[model samples]
Target: MTTTYDPTHPRYDNEGDMRDELLRVYDLCHGCRLCFNLCPSFPSLFEAIDAHDGDVEALSVAEQDKVVDECYQCKLCYVKCPYVPPHEWELDFPRLMLRNTAVRRKHDGLRAKLTDQALGRTDLVGTLSTMVAPLANAVTQTPGSLPRRVMEKVTGIAAERMLPPYARQRFSTWFKKRVTPTLTRRQGSVTVFPTCLVEYQNP
Candidate 1:
């Protein structure tokens, strides 16, 4: 079959259809095992199936969710897969996990769905946090702080996780002020895309 991905496709509209597609991909991945060590998701999937005598159907919903959650969209499996695209066994592991996540978000309760939405807006969060960076940095860094504990409870982020501290001055400000190197020899023009980390947290 010629494989394609469309998030709005009718197949993904029904939870059962999505689950079936996930199970089909899981069975194929279990048989190949080429991406066993690439990411946590692959190993988790393989282990669950192996425990159930190589039967994907034997794995519980919770077990399947855990496997999907372990995949952080690294896409390494897709890059390494010999059976992607034009191949008869067209497996897009990262996209599959993403589709599963979409289904999860759609069915999640209000708080969880909001949390996921907030997490997705990294730029907005970065900008807002950087505005009061010192206070934000202190609260995030202090393991047992009351604010940290409260944030953990509300956001489901671990209180002890060492989050990157935001800079008082944004990267664009610093970059614009810095003196560029004057080249004596002819050189090609260079461009930089300061990612979110460089723009806010690190810079």
Candidate 2:
């Protein structure tokens, strides 16, 4: 659909420079749809784009809200977008969306504070996981346990999911002892990320 922007928009004033840059970046989007297809966010984003193409102001408050809510913030699109590569670095879509998301939060208010809280605090999760581990294990093993239902309700993680048991010792502590300095020359140094499975489940 053909799109047209209004000469006057509520947020348009004093945003000429930003608007120009956004248009320039929009032109760089080749419509290859590679990132679109990869992202779970595309369904909402595609709708917004289609709406705006017909009329810049056609997007209602609800439509814009839904569009921003769908972004998982995983940055998969940033990594997958073909335009992000090359010497030119024509990639601006992710940044643009981020900026738009900020505008959304400011204007529409926060939507996923609980999810953010849960994802951001690793220490809290680790502490809670260890504290209730025995009960957690039993509930998972037991039939029709309340804890099993509660877990699914709060996080939407399936009750039937096979979660690894917590380790008796933390992996970091074990690694400190096991990791020894190699004095031999011509040998390469190894880097390890110590994934969740290896670090927490099987120290």
Candidate 3:
């Protein structure tokens, strides 16, 4: 198995190679278990391996995907790992999982495909949602509501999870109207870049 995180690598998203790499890394992680305290992904992985009598290969694709699903790309494992780039083991669990996601999403259903596409267009979604901020905020105020539950089914984002609320007015709009015009004396000019993360969720 080629231990690689580079997407440009020829075998980066090759399913066959990815499977082999998963097994290799899973076996290493299973033995080290140093990241046991980090996140849900480690616990899930350990439990799955233990259930299969310490055989990493015994984990089915679905089981492996479950472990990946539990990972929220926190990358805490990379910091805790002793076998990252500088070491010969060259393990990068987070990047491997990202590759897994990229490859797997291609085979996802139409709803999931559409949802993924929509999500990638964060600027568009953020703009639209912020345009109707009052109604959007009200509808998504709480988790486990009918709307939230329906959203979970449609987008695969957990209904029990809540993102930071969108600002009634996006930062870009506010900056242009409030700050940009008021900047009579400018020591240094600044550029404000906005994405969904900032424009909606955490603005």
Give the candidate number with the greatest lDDT. Answer: 3
Query: 7-115 in candidate 2: lDDT tens per residue?
Result: 2434522233334444444434424556666555566655565757734245554664464456667778778776664536456455555655554434442324444
lDDT computed for candidate 2 = 0.55
Give per-residue lDDT, candidate 3, residue 48. 98
Provide the clash count, candidate 2. 0
What are the RMSDs of all candidates, in order?
3.3, 8.1, 4.8
The TM-score ranking, best first, is 1, 3, 2
| lDDT score, candidate 2, position 32 | 52
Q: Indicate the worst ten consecutive residues by lDDT in candidate 2.
A: 1-10
Instruction: State the lDDT of candidate 3 residue by residue for 1-203, as single tens digits.
Output: 66677888887778888889988999999999999999999999999999999999999999999988899999999999999987888999999899889878766897788778666787787888888888778767888889988888888767888766667787777766864356567687667777667777666
Q: Model 1, which residues run further than 4 Å from truth?
A: 1-5, 72-91, 193-195
What is the alpha-carbon RMSD of candidate 1 to the true structure? 3.3
Q: What is the per-residue lDDT of model 1 for residues 24-74, given as tens digits with 9 covering 90 to 100?
A: 889888988999998898888998999999989988889988999998888
